[model samples]
Target chain A: MSVKHALLALLEQEPMYGYQLRAEFEQRTGTTWPLNVGQVYTTLSRLERDGLAQGGGEDTEGHVIYRITDAGRDEVATWFTTPVARTQPPRDELAIKLALAVTVPGVDVATVIQQQRSATMAALQDYTRLKRQATGTARAELAWSLVLDSLVFAAEAEVRWLDHCEARLRRAAAELDVQNSRLTDGTSSVKREFRRSTGETHADRTRR
Target chain B: MTAVLQLTDVVRVHGEAPHEVQALRGVSFAAYAGELVAVMGPSGSGKSTLLTIAGGLDQPTSGAVTVEGVDLARLGQPERARMRRTSIGYVFQGFNLIPALTAAENVALPRELDGVAPRQARAEARQALEEVGIPHLADRFPDDMSGGQQQRVAIARAVVAERRLILADEPTGALDTETGEEILRLLRARCDAGAAGVLVTHEARHAAWADRVVFLRDGVVVDETGADRAETLTEPAAR
Candidate 1:
């Protein structure tokens, strides 16, 4: 996801104008992650400022081409070798919403979970459709297909998470109901034995 | 534009009233020729029941089930059996191939039961096997073939005789990921070749191969995705 590193890597291959860089990036990712021409130029300028690349020479069409420097080649090599840092995790809206849904009073958590599952399934279906359309024999097409597969995998994982959340919610609600009934029934031997042995009050049990 | 399989307000109930369990509650669905529709839901959400009802293997407690313009409820047992052998084909998670018969023989059984001559049936089965990309395995027994090969044979049998409606229950469930994908590709190819396919699956990735996805909850249709809607989902932004 590091655009600067991506641009440098493409430059490491060969000199490319802004338009060619954008096109190459989009082609490799199937345009699932479309690069703006301006953004490409901005990254190229930043790379030049950092002495990793030099913008010089002109292609046949009079477009300025960027070439990777020795520093840029080393940067690309390091990028490939280093594991991507995950210390700063990206914000996950779904996880945050689910957390609030569980804690917020009067929220319809089940409906929220179902809605997300449906949406994720729809996205997963679209990725699959795109994948089917991609013949993937060529190198660029195969790269695009891999990008689509990543999206499909992430969407499928989201759906499974939603299903897990729903099940846990249902189980928690059922357990609460059982505890409520036991509290109201003085003759319930399970509750009586638990109170006698652990001395855990109903409030403590509810919190647990 | 005609539907190969249609279920109109279908319902199925189990046991007597005191303990009756409603498996499908007025579920209506249709799969047209050249289309593959995926049915997805949690276990016991009536996905399997819907496939069974569509295939005419189980009777709906109410509502009409139609296949290729024929009302399944109106057919007698013998007539329905004939319909099963001719108009419909079923693929299951398990290959369900006859252990004793070779691949070709197993695929040819349905055609032969429909009264096609033995020679013609075997020929047709070979063609079906070819369509599934396993013509060379025609003489191999199920025990000798890999799981993927057995699944291919199962698909060949389902698609033999150019069955108009194909009902598959988790057809890729028993195979590895790559093998499962190959199986789905075969199913998609068959649907593209004018067979209407109904795939019941819990795996979203498997269901994604279908043209449309229908979700069930507690025996009721809860959500359905449209083809147009699939087009509207935005791609992830460039990082």
Candidate 2:
């Protein structure tokens, strides 16, 4: 999802200040991809370097603005011509945690979720301390603050989800185990098993 | 195998009266099953327009376009649209997702429209979303996703419809280097899944993604190259 064209896509309409661009981007997509002012400006510079855009000149506040060029418009049109299909969010740590939860016999899903919860909670604590301790007015420090905020929120969200997952996994353990055995052995016959439960012959089931 | 799409001297005109524009002119091309072809051209060269006609979403003003062994001009508009909904999966540039719908809902829409049960449709959507690696996002709306994430969700939606032919205008047009590469890889994976896809792009980088690339010039097919192809073509190399 780390596509610079996201910013470029917004720039296709008209020139905008970096701060304005960031705000518009967040508002338009509901902030699915959050960006700091620095990240926005850095991406703008790269786009300018790539000849996809040119600076639109600064306003009274010294904030530089940008607009998509003919080349950039061409790029945008090209961008629109193809269908974007991202099926998978890259490699998520959660995927690995869940995969092993079932494959490793006796490996407790609840325990794994708890382990992640505690680790993430600890990390969130450190982020909190670092965010509070920072007092400098440096631009870099302010930028770090935004990143830290994102990290803190994400860590907190994960811990919350892990707790919910632990409860669900525990409650479903017995039933999941029966299903799990059939799934693992690859012997769950859809027709035979369904007929056995319904007490109907295969021919009768097919007729119905 | 039947040619999935065959365009013979097709033309598409837009606008009327005081002004007129020809998006396509005497363009001819063919796509076979199991083929992944790239459509390449400069802006306004009409590659996207041509793809829409080939996919049966737009009608040609003159000449002929035969899709799925049926003459497109022969089919009624409603029938053509149904054919498109069932046979063609379009990956658009803007990711045109339904913001109000959950990721799974978006993926299951075509099926629901085709009258599949909501529960059954959702089950299929879940599988498709899982195939694309965002099954967890099934409950989230488009607003809650990243650009790459939204695109993945869109891809799952496109494929989940169970369409056999894909007409992608620029599957990676909006992403950075890494994300674009990921998109191209996924599109290629679609081809490996026994579905044929036609990709249109201005970048030569994606020329590798197609079994063939049909370069367009002034709305005409100029050159056709296979995968692993390199040619001077007297045109500047695509960046």
Candidate 3:
């Protein structure tokens, strides 16, 4: 996710041109997150401008090589030690869909949840299959497997969330059924008062 | 490859007149040798109905259900029961292991019921249990083993006599995530080893283990696609 830090870390190993940096990054990460040539140049230029990297003399092929500055090394060190922050979670589309589905009257919430669950499960299977195909002992394989594992874990969490949503919706429907039956048991007015007092809170909980 | 199990224009209607429920409305499906096809649908969408018809546990109304090119309807009740015992394997969500029997005994029960020698049935059961990675649990009773282990035994029972058509209904429903995946892997492996499998599951991830997915809705085959495309089909479209 931090392309700058990744580029900086790669540059720390040796002086390299834009293309070499891109190749090295992809090689190390197993090309899971490919780095484009233009993006590499842009990041390199930013690094130079920010005093984190300096343009070195051209190589024999007239390609401009870049070397990491002391500041870049410090940044890479810090990035490696810091844990990723989770307080401000990324806006997940599936989460947003379910949240909207619960409150929207016309939406088929069960279908929405089931569809998303299927998608996440497919992704999880892809990850698992990919993991099985990757049989390497290099550090790149290790790095790539870690990245793949993160995706697998995220997809697994998504599936569990979808299952929870389905269960909650079923519970809500059952409760609604129970309320409807009570309404017909000659306690309509009393039941209406209870619903008015507590239904709002229940609705809020369901939305969450 | 020839389909080991095929349902042609299968229609299964329950009850009569006003109370009749068309659980499967002209549904046609097939599972070829060495292929695992997952059947997915919401509850009461005829998923179980489809699986039962395919396994010959239930007959379809005004349609054909064939296993290994043999029509199930043409067979008498006794022969149909024999077919179920020797050629078809069914795994349920409940594990469905006989608590009174040991794991090996439960697995061997199907083969023994088909008139296999007790010694031979037990040997085949042990081999099946070993394939499921739980050979040591063979002597353990259903109540003595963990849920995952019980499910493995159930799977062993399903495949004990080398049944070519395996039908599973939410086989991984009761297990933890890791164990569920393990069970799916076993099913996938079985299909790879020349068995035809039909898995009825609500979970898309489990279906990913299959070669193809058949989506059902309102007792109809809504969409049939490769497992890889399942995610794209479910993606939210632009309104």
Mind giving the per-residue lDDT tens digits that candidate 1 earns over B1-239? 44788899999998889699999999988888888889989899999999999998999999999999899999999999999999998999999999999999999999998899999999999999999999999999999999999999999999898899999999989889889999999999999898999999999899989888998988999888764422332222442
Cα lDDT, all candidates: 0.90, 0.75, 0.85
Model 2 C-alpha lDDT per residue in residues A1-208, reported as the tens digit of each score: 5447877888887788888888766654434357888888898899899999898678899888898878888887887887777776668878577778857898867557645644554565456546555546765466566666667667767755665675567568878898888778765689568869889875785798
Q: Give the alpha carbon lDDT tens digit for every residue of B1-239 in model 2.
A: 55667789998889985487888889978766666777866678899999888888788889998877789788887888777767778888789999889999998998888788999999999998988888788999999888888888888877885677778888787887668757767777787677777899866555445667676766877556552222222122673
Give the per-residue Cα lDDT of candidate 3 at A25: 86
DockQ of each: 0.52, 0.01, 0.18
* A1 Cα displacement, candidate 2 (Å): 36
Which is better, 2 or 3, measured by TM-score?
3
Expressed as tens digits, the lDDT of each residue in B1-239 for candidate 3 is: 35688889999899998799999999988777777888877788899999988888888988999999899999999999999999999999999999999999999998988899999999999999999999999889999999889999989999987899999999999999879978988998998898989999987667767777787877998666564332333342552
Per-residue C-alpha lDDT of model 1 across residues A5-120, encoded as one tens digit per residue: 98999888889999999999999997777889899989989999999999999978899999999999999999999999999989999999999999999999999988888788
TM-score of chain B of each: 0.94, 0.90, 0.93
lDDT of 1: 0.90
Candidate 3's displacement at residue A106, Å, is: 15
Which residues of candidate 1, in runs, are more than 4 Å off? A183-208, B227-239
Which regions of candidate 3 are displaced past 4 Å? A9-24, A27-30, A41-45, A48-132, A135-208, B227-239
